[model samples]
Target: MTVRRPAHEPAEPLEERLRKLEKINRALMGRVERSTDFSGNGFSLFQTAIVLEGQVSARTSDLKRTLEDLSDAYARLEDARDDAEEAKQNLTSAIEAVSEGFALFNDAEELVMCNTPFRALLPDIETRLAPGTPFPRIAEFFSQSRHLVLDQHRSPEAWRAARIDLFRKPHAAFIQKLSQDRWIQVSNKKTDTGATVVFQTDITDIVRAERLRRERELDEQSKILQATLDHLPQGICMFASDLRLKAWNHRFIDLLSLPLRLVTPLASFERIWEWAGKSVFVHDGAGVAAVSGWLRAPSADLDSIELGKSDGSILSVSGNVMPDGGIVVSFADVTEERRASAALREAKETLEQRVEERTAELTREVIERRAIEVELIKARDTAEELTKSKTRFLAAASHDVLQPLNAARIFLSLLGGTGLDLRQQHFAGKVDKAFGSVEEVLGTLLDISRYDSGSVEANIVPLSVAEILTTLAAEFQPLADQKQLRLRCMPSGLYGLSDARLLRQIIQNLVSNAVRYTTRGGVLVGARRRGGMISVEVWDTGPGIPADKRDFIFEEFRRLNQDVPDTPKGAGLGLAIVRRIARLLDHPIAVRSVIGRGSCFSIELPLCAPPRRVEHKASAERLPVDLASFTAIVIENDLAILEGMMELLQERGMRAIPAVSIGEALETLQSLEKTPDLIIADYHLDQGTGTDAIAAIRRAAGHAIPAIAVTADQTAKVQAEIRKDHIAYLRKPIKTGDLFALIRKVIAE
Candidate 1:
């Protein structure tokens, strides 16, 4: 590059201009002298001298100003040169300070500058990396250098061609692995000045760490696979694609009896198999090619080949090709299994003869068979009492476990009746409600067990529909009233044929359940005649049952709220019993319900002539006697039960007293204002028998006094004893409906 002066500045040096100007002045003076001597005219010479002198002085002044301008321009040019040199030093220092090897190339692709690392990385070409060297030359040196880790599969020519092709790209980054196992990341970036900068970063540590992790993982996997193969029960051997043995467990050697030298690593599978010995099929026309053939070209199917030895041993051989083209073969001894199968076949062929011999003894079995069957029938009939495996563990559960259970319920019920604070009543109500649930579960279980054993007999008979319904209403009205629900019953003079006892129980259960679940509206019981049938429907305004669950509701242990997580109260057996009873009576029951409205259960009964029996239980003349008005003596061997019954009766406004045993009965009677209206005594009392105590109490009162014997033991012996005394018998739980009806009936008689 050349430096040119500005247009207004002098082209020549000030000293040179001064020298030329002085020389011209001297020439003019010489000319003046010559004119003076040659022309011989002093006047002309004098004029020439003045003019020459004046001109010389003006020329001198102009030279001085020209020199000053040149001096200022030279000073500014020097400062500019210094600043350019400083900038160059700063750029050089900055590039050297960078960690990565830096090299800059001009737009012509020629090397402009480079840091120490750039040439340091390529020691072989260090001398060649100069300012004049082109970018392609450096790339060629890098590709051909001994340090370059070239691909073994690729020709050096191809790798070089690709590397050079990428040199001119605007932005490029690639990884270059050195022969020394170092990793370098190289990036080529274009500068705004139409230059390119290459950066090479060493990532040896990171790459080595990653490779180590991968190697460790592969090693662990190898160890795990070997361990699993060694522990396998079957003899196993794995071969590489080349059909050379890669792995084999000791079992393979022992099972096949192969030579140890033939089963070593890199041993040919063909040689190993040959030494393992030839296996021929026990059955003709069943054979397979050598496993080595499958190793060469395996199919997806993995069926096994069976081979038998001369010693009556059979082997099952199976093989599969691995994902990496390796093949694994397994051998299993199935000798025992094969023999057992053959024996089973032989037995089946000869089984008819044994059956014939057994059948021939039929004549002799007649007497003994009847005797065995008779014993089985008797055992099943009294299964609950004798076996203790049915009927809620047979009647024992009802007596032992439920004795305290009944007492708890009674006490809880009595507590709810007391005028405690709101919170106390709420808690007591929940406790009582829980006890009721337990009773329902136990009762339902007992009912299910009895039904299963065919112990519950359905006694079908003629019954008055109106009287039955009136009795049901009277029994459940108090329960409904407690919940502030209305119980509506439409009296029907028309009667239908049904079991009086069971029909009452069915309607009674329906009304009782309706009162229990109904939180609003009421339960409506009405009857309508449809042609030759009477439909006795019970409707309840409660959480309606789903249509899907309508049939399921009658299933034992099934509830209407099965879809929700919350388990609703009730053992889900009420409707189940209803279904069973309806079937027994030849009555078809139907149910219709809406999601939020209510449910109606209708029992279709065949229409029949009115019954001849007259029922005056609901007559207006007889005052509605709820057990609340009467007084009774509660004789229970269990103190808790005695207290619970006394509290329960008194809470309902009855003048009741407690008697723990037979001895307490006399004391309780002597304390009563009037010979207690009724006697409620447990059969298994503390001392002397409860029936004996009841007889004594009756003798003291001078009349029967409406005696009722309550007992946890429902055995035939206990019931017979209570009945022989002419007293009433109720089960352990003492169902309120049955108890109340029995009490009223016994009192009236």
Candidate 2:
């Protein structure tokens, strides 16, 4: 009857089933004893027990399925929690990577999170700014530690209150200056959860740049104002409201005769006024009071006051007041104008008196006027005679003055020919330079005399312009080379009707002027056709003439003030002489100039056809013949000149015969065994003229001997006389080069 129970069944359920079976058996026995019915009831009870067993197995299966479902749901919930934690960590790392300081606060104003820079911004209270820290407490900590530097005018408590007020309701971003002179821009934004995020950025460099830009603008304005004041014509001085000098110009110092040290900026006006009173203004008793009253006036339109000094100087001073309570004063020197006005008033009064007196004596004056007229005429004639006498004296004394200079020049030339040391040569060169200066002065005087006396005559003939320009270029080439300037002469196949010698002189002077004034570039000589005449122009790259001064430059003793370095100033007579010579030759001279560019001087001469053939003279090269093989006869009025000539000739290894008169020259030539090869005679002899002496010498020699006429007279008549005799002429003081070249040429012919 022991049936096997299922191995998987619960022990408690099985035991309870066994106990219930025993109880049912006992209840069946009792029922059997009590009542013997066992039919339909027994069958119904057996079916009910079977149905209960099936229901128990179904309930056990349902409980097991419910337990498995609960375990799977628990695993899904744990995975979701892990994903949420990783998302939170990523958000924090992103916020910490920002360069700017960052902080977050909850709605209750308690600190939620903060980056390292946020805490570093307030290093003293870095721990206090941790999580859960109240915003008000953080502000209190900053205020106590002096971490935030408010405006200098605000107290810490007031600033903290204001900052808290702003924190409660932030409008926009604001900049705060921190301790140690650092600057920060702070911005606040609200998150979706009602928390606040604060961003801080350093802006010190931007602030510094703004300050520098303002400083540069101020400096530029100051420079412009200073330049404007300096360039003003009038003497200007500015004073501050306190009557201290702020600025002044050099003209102000010069006008007031103020000391240089007293003219500095920030100088007190009182010191300047005292200096002016002592040095510039007349120190009368009332001068000090008057000046003080004028300076201290509140706002007055000051009339120009003329101040007089003990040294006969007058200054006009005017004052003006600015809207800012500052003062400006102007000074002008008016001494000359005042004196002129006084003189004119006195003259006018004197003239009125004289007119009244003359009216009363008109009849008496009429009778005496004829006699006065005659006397005036005689005085005029006497003046004319004196002028003529002066001209004659100058012309006559030119030879006497130049004789010794000529002899000295020849002696110096011979001395230069001899070898010498460097120091000796330098001294000799200095002497030569002295002689050159003397020659220039003498030549100028002689030319002026000759032009004034109407002695220069123009022999107008067909002449080659190229020939003259070429000669000039050759003469001035050395000078141009020394100055490092290019000299160009264009070849012109054209001819002009002009005097060859006078034309040469005019062109030479112009070229010399061009070379002297030009600092760079070059000088060009060329000709251009104008109407029926040819204009020969000399162009130079030099400081040009002002339009106002163009006509004045041709006047006597007129020169432009051109401050070129290392260039020697001339006597200012070159243009004057050129004008005179141009008029004498009937050639028109014109000048065109620009102020800073250059100038062109041109002369118009009537154009003519060139000759069939032009024969140019031989160049002035040294001769091949020995000078000692020739005999030279010299005639002069002065013994010293005659002896000097002999000495100079003997030095040159030439045979020289000296004589003072025509008779002496003839006697000396007759004593010579052979005909004289050359004869040098002075224009004015002791007894007869040099022309007469040359004639006598030629007659005695019985041949037409070559001769030279040396003279200081540059008149056309003297030149004509020498040329008429077919003799060469050299001007005095004679150039050694010319003398030797002429002698060599004559001997060679």
Candidate 3:
């Protein structure tokens, strides 16, 4: 069955349908008027209907293409929407990945988004922190939950107002602390859309490090202060505001002699005061009060106090005030300086008293001495005149006395040498011994005179001690043997600056005394080296002197009793002469003795370097065999001495000429057929001295004749005169052997 279409629904083109309908209507009207023209009109209407159907087909194809293009555009729009959603998911993931809390706020100050860390920052209010939550509400939740740890004194309203105010202002970084004492640094940045991005960083480690650095600095400062206090010389102690010992140095303990156990930081000042009062400041009554007062008002400055102790020590104590109600004290010891000042004051007083007494005594002595001085001067003049007379008498008497003695000695010697019976020889020896004693007494008198007159001048030279020892040994050996005593002289190589003649005399007297006193054992003569001097000591096993007599022995004419029967007694002038000679030579003498053992006598002589070598005449000890061929001239003022000298020379087998004066000697030489080999002259001549007579004869003969001066003048002036003439000098009553030796030595030369 075919459905009928509604009239409003047109299935074909309107223009073509409208044209067909119009043609059919026009033909119906015309046929009614003229039915014969209907076939031609129907054909024109059919062509118009065909054109309308073609146009309707083209329009339907164009509408179908437009519908397909609209479907493709809708599919592209769906793809772009999916890509935008994926980009938003990536941005949210990156924000959540950060370790710090991060959040974003919109322009209206509402919470738009936040990471999990931001939510964790406020865990109690994390549920309230969501998108579209206002910042003021979040701040209120943080305050209620105590999440931000804001000021405890501030109200919640104020805290919320402050947070809102900070949020609305231009974004900046600031710090926040949590209620758990963790630190957070908040940094905010404003976006282009007027939202804020906040980053919170935990900074607890940095805060702890800063705190530790401050602590270390404080510790260093404390150490430096302690070191400075310890090095101070003065004892130091510091008390704190609580009136307790806060610090002290080791010196403080040492200075006060405090117990170590009682001293420590925060120790009570009262306890220290009690200990100091009992020990160090035993006598000071103010010590306890001072400590109490210092502790009570530690900021008050105090003056230094000088406190004394029972043990004779003094302490200077001073205190200073600290700004923080504390006290610093120092101590100094001042004992020695105070004592020294007192001693000096006492000495000054004593010295002044002594000076006053001495001055008074001197004033009295000056008055008394004036009266006695006049008498002393008169006595001294009289004594001097007597001494001069004594000297002249001895000089005059020596020649007269010695002239006969010398002749007797020569005759006795000559008679002994001749043929004689034993009895006659014994008689001659006895007489010779008597003459020897007389000669000794006279010689001693002469030596004492020379010393008293100061005529024995010292001719100091460098002489070997060995040489003097050798001579002494040879001279004393016979004496020692006669007494059955050993005499020894130890070899010495030391030299001294001394007068050889005076030294020999001093040693001879000592040795002679030794030999005289000793009857057994030996005498030892030796030298020892002392600093810058040589000690020539004579040790003898003699009848040792008694202690009481030791000092008296050196006095003139003081003798000890002789114990040995066969030992000869001395005139006691030996040691007396020794004392005088030692004094003249400026040498010190010492004597040590034991009653039964022996004695040692030592003389100190200055040590000297050996002198330059000089040609010295060899010592003559014996007559030569050529004595008989020598000729001699004798000049003497005394007839007996002249004959004695002539006979002694002739007996020794030599030609001898006797002349009483220089004129006689000159005449005797002119009458001689040859020049005399030697001249022997007397120093005290009627014409001139022996030296003058010899000079006259030497001039007449036109040559320097080898001469000998025989003089009774023992004065140094006469001896020096003879020596100045280069002639040998012989003392009065000369020994026969010595004269012969001198004659032989001179002629041989």
Candidate 4:
């Protein structure tokens, strides 16, 4: 039996066929047969086939559902592929963005991928990295040599540490030759799959900064050590165990004055020791073992020592042991302090010697002073004895001397009144002249006594210099003529206020000295202008004073070139009187002389002019003197002077009257016994002065009297007082001629 079936049968549909196969697979078996049979018989199979065709039509619907499941699975597989591609791109970008160079390598040390930075390290290499390129082969192409990757465990120890490869290990360290050399840091890492990653960063600036920092720190430490050593006062040095100098400060160099080659080296100590001495060797620690004597014991150390230099300078030295088996020594010079101490000791010794000598001299001086005291007492006793002797002599002689002088003056006057022959008259004139000279001597002695005893006082007045000179010349002309010396005067019409009598004395003494000393040339009286003053000078061509003795001549009792030794003349009180008077008048006196030629004595005095007029009272007791006849009215308080004046007036052919007071004179004028021709009054009247008496007489008579005043006190103030009455003044011991001449002038006026 043969059988066949339809191709499109329901029982044999493709979907159903696959499902049946799947079902047979699910059944337990090692393997399963695939078939489209439900029953075993071929005819049954044929019959089902026709039925299966119809079922195939229904299975065709299942084909669409199976297509939708396949499309969903394909969509999920596409998404997984896209995610993997994006992750690969992100890894590439991250590698490029990092600053350090980067690369990846395989297990055999072959480059897989390299970034731009790593490519830049090798400009000649291909920009894109690929597999299976030997790392050393590529490195040699760029770096011109094998750039090995480090494998410390497999490589030789020294070479392993130094391994660096620019291509395989992108971060490998490298050197760059710039202005200066520079360094770079490199790092590498590997995954479990044996792929490597490399990183690199340039570190040249940091390395340079570190090197500079180290150098600066070293330099700073060296400077600080050197500066500290230089400031030390003592010499400092270090010696090695081999006895070589290892270090030294500036002070040690300067102390030896060593050369620069010697200064910065260890040999300087030996050179200094050669120039200075073995004394420079400090000798305990720094010195040779021979000098220290410590060679036998290795533990022996330093000792202190002092040495004096050849220049007599002392040095103090000390030594110490160092930890490195060397020695250090120091020295100080102390010469100046020693010298100062020596000088101070010497000074103290000298002072002690001086004190002893001064003490001895002072003792001798005390003994000498006692001797001088004894001599002084004896001299004082002798002076007292001499003073008593002088007092007795003056008392005994004063009365005898004055009585004889009075009698002689009276006799001379009486003889003049009588008629006399020419010879007798000539003898009478000689006697009068001799008596006048004697009176001058007595008066000068009296003046000296009065001046010395402080009894004389100045009577200052204003007077004309012309008048003083005229009066002096009138008194001294005869003496000047007898001596044949011209006594000349320069007219000084100037006036001054001074004691007129004292001024006259000063001038008279100077003039007398001039006349006595002068022989041929004239004596000149003149005045020179001083500041606010007039300096009156008496100059003569006389024996000038010797320069040696000129100052001595003005002293009391000094005489010069005296020829008339027995005359009892000047008594040498003249210049002394002049000096005293100049002092009294507050005038300055000076003398100048030339030996054997002349002398000049000058007196400086303040200048004053006379007043315009002097007022006076009128006298009425006397009539005016007759024009032809000489008449006189004599007023004398003493009867002797009154009678003497009366007799002298009558002899001169002038009528005279005597009244003692102003009232008596008025009564006498009223009686009209005789109207006096000229009035003469003694300055001292009984009731009032002659000046008042004269005024009374003039009032009664109704006219001024041509009166003359007579007084023995010849002081300038007394003369001025009398002259204030507008009358003629005369000094007592009156001369007959002056009396007659004054009366004649009044009558003539």
Query: Model 1, range 574-655, lDDT digits (tens) per residue?
Result: 8888877777677888888887788888887767886565566664455457767788888887876777677666656777
Off by over 4 Å in 4: 1-411, 445-478, 490-504, 530-533, 546-558, 563-568, 606-631, 637-640, 658-670, 685-689, 692-704, 745-749
How many backbone clashes can be found in candidate 4?
18
Per-candidate Cα lDDT values, in order, are 0.70, 0.76, 0.75, 0.61
Off by over 4 Å in 2: 1-381, 609-623
Model 4: per-residue lDDT, tens digit, 1-749?
A: 11222322332243454455455434422221232467678888887787666555544444344344334334434444555567768988998887777878888888777778766653445543455676655444433312323333544343433444333443444433222353456567767787777665666687677556545633443444354445556788767676667668877766645565655545644555555554333333333433244322224333445555545665665565443457667766656645655655665565456556667676564454344345434544544444444433432233333333433454467556665434456766766775675556555654554454444577677777777777887777888898887888778778777878788889988888888767777888877666668788999898788888777787765766644332223456688778777877788888898887899999877777666876788745655554336455567766644655566556656556667777777777887755666677766665777777777777777888688776555444666778887888865456666756676665555
Best by TM-score: 2
- Candidates in order, TM-scores: namely 0.40, 0.50, 0.49, 0.39
Kindly report which residue stretches of model 1 are placed more than 4 angstroms away from their true locations once superposed: 1-389, 413-419, 453-459, 469-491, 508-535, 538-551, 564-569, 583-601, 604-607, 613-633, 646-678, 686-689, 712-749
Which pairs, if any, clash in model 1? none
Q: Positional deviation of 628 in candidate 1, in angstroms?
A: 13
Please give the clash total of every predicted structure, in order: 0, 0, 0, 18
Clash pairs detected, candidate 2: none
Alpha-carbon shift of residue 722 in model 1 (angstroms): 5.9
List runs of model 3 lying over 4 Å from the truth: 1-369, 392-397, 614-625
Give candidate 1's error at residue 287 in angstroms.
45
Candidate 1 accuracy as lDDT:
0.70
- Highest-lDDT candidate: 2
The local lDDT score (0 to 100) that residue 119 gets in candidate 2 is: 80
lDDT of 2 at 157: 87
